[model samples]
Target: MNLIEQLKTILSEEQVTTNDVILEQHSHDESYHTPHLPDVVVFPNTTEEVSKVLQFANDNKIPVVPFGLGSSLEGHVVPEYGGISLDMSQMNQVLEIRNQDFLVRVQPGVTRTQVNKELNKHGLFFSVDPGADATLGGMAATNASGTTSVRYGIMRDQVRDLEVVLADGTVIHTGGLSAKSSSGLHLNGLMVGSEGTLGIITELTLRVFGIPEKITAARATFPTIQNAVDAVVAVMSAGIPMARIELVDTRSIQQVNTSLETTFEEAPTLFLEFHGSEAALQYDVAFTQDILKDYNCMNFAFEQDSKARNALWELRHNLAYSFIHSAPGKKLMVTDASVPINELPSAILHSRAKIEEMNLDAAIVGHVGDGNYHVLMMIDLSNPYEIEQAKILNEHIVNFALSKGGTCTGEHGVGIGKAKYQALEHGAAYEVMKSIKKTLDPNNILNPGKIFRDINE
Candidate 1:
């Protein structure tokens, strides 16, 4: 039987589809990388189904690309080899909520928002919010984190265990429900950020957190990027418990105000959040304000009410969408990099200088507390000059971060976009990674063309 006929035999005809619309949707993620449609898309409803599909593909030597919500910033979900795009959306379910243990076991298709909605009913919440309402499985695959990562940590920290399917369709469980263990290999960590090259995640046992007693938000505008970054360093040095610390450049602030019609100052600004008792929040705010004053802080707006605090974060979170809204037809060429905390000021400075030199239309924003940031630009894909300029600016920013002994990618995984930097950033360690990949996936049928590149091993 042909591949489509075999898929239909394994699953109902309605579950396995060759429709062009669905194929196009699974072709690429949110990245600007070129898209290629998969030959077939299969919706798997359980771990057994996923295993059977993998076993079949392993036997036939067909590539298998797992699909989530298609919200990734990198081209992590793009099917470059045009095989089966295993759509995991059919497996969405919150299997168990161990409220007393502060943990939850969910299917790979469960989204961050959906888990939070369930957790909220028990007066608990998930800590890692990557801005997009992405699936928890996708977040684990990329080891993603965002605003809350400055406090609660990234996806790797949240994953207590995972139910994974091996390349040969063998099912295995990694880790357990305990808080910590010294039993054996840390397979959970290894699989969390593998980008589907190592194994496919079937179910995730994640740790959740209780809602804070009091949550407050604030905006601090600075005269320059250096001042804003220095202020962030001060907060960390002082050991202030910050929930989040984000930076938006003056141009980005202007774009936000223009797109959202808010009256925020068009200056280098910091959007901060604090989670603690009301009194503690006030004390931290006062101490943070004092530090900012030394750095020429132009404005400080303290938001204590929940509505106002949400509005402040909404403004910061919507900055990228603002650029998209203002320019209807242009493609967004977004890229991200990370650096050590002390090196953040220089990194942003170098990036700004290059952006100004290239005269590219762009905005700068970041999770400044963690020394991670992004460059948001609307590009014309048809213009080779524009594409080349974007690549140059991205490389310049990545090089600056790498020179500081940091990574080419911080939160976003090394998809096709950042695959070329693996050898440059990792050196000999990159080879070890390739060896591991080739060992786990001998046929290289799982998510081909990711992380490592140009390997003939």
Candidate 2:
């Protein structure tokens, strides 16, 4: 039987859509890549339904693309090969919230904001925030990290267990609530950041932290990027336990100031947040300010008022949107590269020089406390030379990071855009990845043309 016929029999007509409108919607993600329409879009409401869909697709050698909120900056869910786009929106139900255990079980389609809203009622919250209100599944798929990552690590660290549907529709539980494990191969590690190539995450058990009693946010400005990075390095080395430490270059600051309609010094700025008791928070800020003195901090300001602090972080969180607002019609090609903690300053300095030499209008910003940063370049997609310049710059940056024992991507996974650098970054590990991919997806139907391309082709 044909793939469409099999799908029709197993799922309701509304669950499967061949409509151009739905296909078009699922074709693209938040990236620079052109959209490719999927042959069909399926909304599976249950884990069993998803497994059934995957099983049929696997049996028929059909490509299956697991989709979350489509917030991925990389083209991980673009449906490039034109197969089944498995939409998980309908499955967005909070399955369970174990308050005593400080864990929550959620369906793949639930958004981070939604999780937070619900968890707020219980006085518990998930710490991983990528600033996009991205789905937990997509965050896990990308192993995403953001400002808070400096204190609470990334999505991978928060995941306690995953109910992943394998390529062959086998449902497997990777890990449980217990912290450490000395078992066999880490299926959880394999599934997280696999970019939907390994399997589809149906349900996730995530760690939740108690909402801090007091939150103090501050903004510090420096004359140079080096000073900003140096201050962050000092803070980290001092073990201050900052909840958020983000670096925004001068160019990005201008963009945010214009977009946010707020006056900020057009210099490298660091937004920081500390979470603790009232007294401890005060002491932390004082100590942080003292440390910043050595870096020649141009300005240091803190917000104790809830409303003002929210406004401050709102600007920092939405700084990426400032790039959009500044460029009006231009699309951004962002690079999330990370180097060793000590090497971050040099790495960012190198990137700044390359951008100037290339004469590209780009902004550098990131959760720099983790040695991870993104170069958000506003590219005129119509200009061939400009696109070529971006590719060259991206290659140069990736090569630089790889040479310094850094990763091609610190947060963004190797979707189609960064897949080319996989071999160089992974080497023999790349072959091992391919072997695993082949073992799990022999037909190469799950997210085809992603992570690894056809060797001969």
| Each prediction's number of clashing residue pairs | 0, 0
For candidate 1, which ten residues in a row score worst on lDDT?
448-457
TM per prediction: 0.98, 0.97
Residue 21 lDDT in model 2? 90
lDDT of 2 by residue, 1-457 (tens): 6666679888998898888898888998889988899999999989999889989988888889988888888899999888899998898999899999999999999999999999999999899988898888999999998879989989889988999998889999999988779988888888899989988999999999999998988899998999999999999999998999999899988887787777888999999999989999888899999999999998998787999998887887787777876777788899889999999999999999999998888889988989999998888899998889998998888999999999999998888888998888889989989999989888887898878875325
Q: Summarize candidate 1's per-residue lDDT along 1-457 as a digit string, tens digits.
A: 8999998888889889999999999998988889999999999999999999999999999999998999987898899999999999989999999999999999999999899999999999999988888999999999999999999999999999999998999999999999999999999999998989889999999999999999988888988999999999989888999999999999998898788777888889999999988899889889989988988899998888989888887777777778887887777878899999989889888899899999988888999899999999998888898889889999998988999998898898998989999999999999988898888888998899988656554
* Local distance difference test values of all predictions, in order: 0.91, 0.89
Error of 2 at 12 (Å): 0.5
Off by over 4 Å in 2: 455-457
Largest TM-score belongs to which candidate? Answer: 1
Q: What is the lDDT of residue 220 in candidate 2?
A: 94
Worst 10 residues of 2 by lDDT: 448-457
